[model samples]
Target: MNKQIIDHLFEFWEQIGKHGNFLTKENGFSFAKPTNGSWPNKVFDLTMEKLDIHALCEEIISEELPNSIAVPENEAIKDLLRSKGLRATSKIKAMTLDTTNIFFGNIDASEFIKVGSPTEAELFAQVATESFGYPVDPSTIGALVDKPGFQIFLGNHENAFPSCGMVYLDQNGVSGIHMIGTKAGYRGLGLGKKMTQFLVNQSIENQSKEVYLVASQAGERIYTKMGFTTHGVLESYSLSLH
Candidate 1:
């Protein structure tokens, strides 16, 4: 796995901490309580090399009540977790945009709106929830309004708020697309692709050397058409309480 992709994912979760509670220790154990029924409310970076896997799993089970554990795919860790009774529940691809040659369908720049205030941020969150079928804390979106290098864009189709996208640019010149979505009724309207292109263009304007994202299965094709190639796989494991 590319280190930049890994770091960007970690940074994405770290920014989620701004809205609620997030903890990352030097030992590499980290967790966030985004309270949005989102992936941020789980454990991350759990490599057995950094901590005792059994003890860590037990601790998360007892104290953290972790909904999942996300880590770069590793056969050793996967086998060990399976041996310990955990199973991978899902997998998402980590992809990087080919910044040198980006291509997206034509979209009028006027169709998208920049999310700059709390009210607009909340609207963006609502669109995300409607699109992804998961709760997104509006407070979390609002919190990013003032965060440096975090930008959110919302798309309006037929006078309705139907799509939203976010981009995070770290000081290290790595930019990541996050939480991009279009409402169920808005699918096939090219809103998502437009929002993505808007964010990518913004990142390029910010002088980002790399742009990446963890793409959902449904979103893989959209990104693929935009010249994003799979760089790695991130496996998500769920602990069976029973």
Candidate 2:
């Protein structure tokens, strides 16, 4: 795994912090959007080095933030989290794609549209929540798209929004695909793949040299088939207040 890519992934989270409150310390950074019902309202890019886990956990608990952390998967961190009564919630694959070798399946390009305005952002968020079985605030989505180097693409089938994906391009030419999803009813139509390809294409056009994403279990197969290979794992832990 390239350390540069890993660092950029963290930087991507920092970029996300721009739309809301952000706090950075020696060990890590925390983000929160109290008005936005999104998952990023928690700490990320955590490193246990030179830090006090107990104090950090207490601070998070006292602040009433989501007791969530994303860090590299390892026994030491796991044990530390366990000591704090945090349990693993998910193990995400860190996958990268060779944007130059990306494959685009046979899908109508006309069905895909670039999300640019608040209305389109709302539609994209709605489709993403429906596809991924999660809740996302349209205002957050809209604010995100308004940032530089962020692009959202949506798939419109039969004049209805069914799938969506996003790409982040940083100044360092690092790109990442985030929140790709297709509605359950429209799964077999390959809209997810199409939306992914569209984002990849956008990344390449933006002069991004490398593109990556944290893949969910269901998305691992889709990304692998599209020429992405797993480079590392990110473990998510949720600390129990009790």
Candidate 3:
């Protein structure tokens, strides 16, 4: 529950969330980053001069996405890419956002979930695998927590076992969620719902007007039930270096 950890985790999620694989040079800065494939080709002209950003984008798309992907481009962009000896392909990044009705009713703050310290690596890994659909190693999850501003919250049942659903709070006024699953063999219970409501209430209390996350297919319904409308999807892509 350290404020510093909460701030750092938020910053890290922002940098990697919108930019995906692009490296950040500045510190303590946040911006409304353009999602994948939404950039104007002129951005390439400006960004590619020093960074092989276009190539990196291409590589990311090929490696991560192979179906229904097209990186948008204009004739000028095509020429620019061709001149650089790189071929161009157009693609779309699914982006969704809703601001009209984004709030969930307040719940009892006393019933809040308990957030453990940064050392709970195994617990973090389990959530990552089940909720986020990521095969994160325990060490990797721990390292992420070890980062300066990563704050994670865990929900427990009678202090015996984790009920699944951990919230990652960041400093960017955006709270992200991961590992939000009901415990195996405990499905159909309302544990997942309560945990989500707790986090949303907490995020709003912290002054975050909007919540964002990359939801899995199965978990999308849960988020929708919690009043989080789809903001948009960034079609992920990855290409080989060869």
The best candidate in terms of lDDT: 1
> Which runs of model 3 end up more than 4 angstroms from their true locations?
1-11, 14-115, 130-133, 144-149, 164-172, 240-242
lDDT rank order:
1, 2, 3
- Model 1, which residues run further than 4 Å from truth? 24-26, 36-39, 101-105
Error (Å) of candidate 2 at residue 153 is 1.5
Report the lDDT tens digits of candidate 1 across residue range 125-175.
Answer: 789888877778887788778678788888888888889988888768778
77: Cα error in model 2, Å: 3.2
Higher-scoring candidate on lDDT, 1 or 3:
1
Q: Candidate 2 regions off by >4 Å?
A: 21-28, 101-108
lDDT of 2 by residue, 116-201 (tens): 89899889878978887767778777778768878878888888888888888866778888888889998898777778777877
Cα error of candidate 2 at position 85, Å: 1.9
- The TM-score, computed over Cα atoms with residue i paired to residue i, of candidate 3 is 0.53
Q: On TM-score, who's better, 1 or 3?
A: 1
Give the clashing residue pairs of candidate 2, or none. Answer: none
Each candidate structure's TM-score, on Cα atoms with residue i matched to residue i, is 0.89, 0.87, 0.53
Worst 10 residues of 1 by lDDT: 18-27
Candidate 2 global TM-score: 0.87
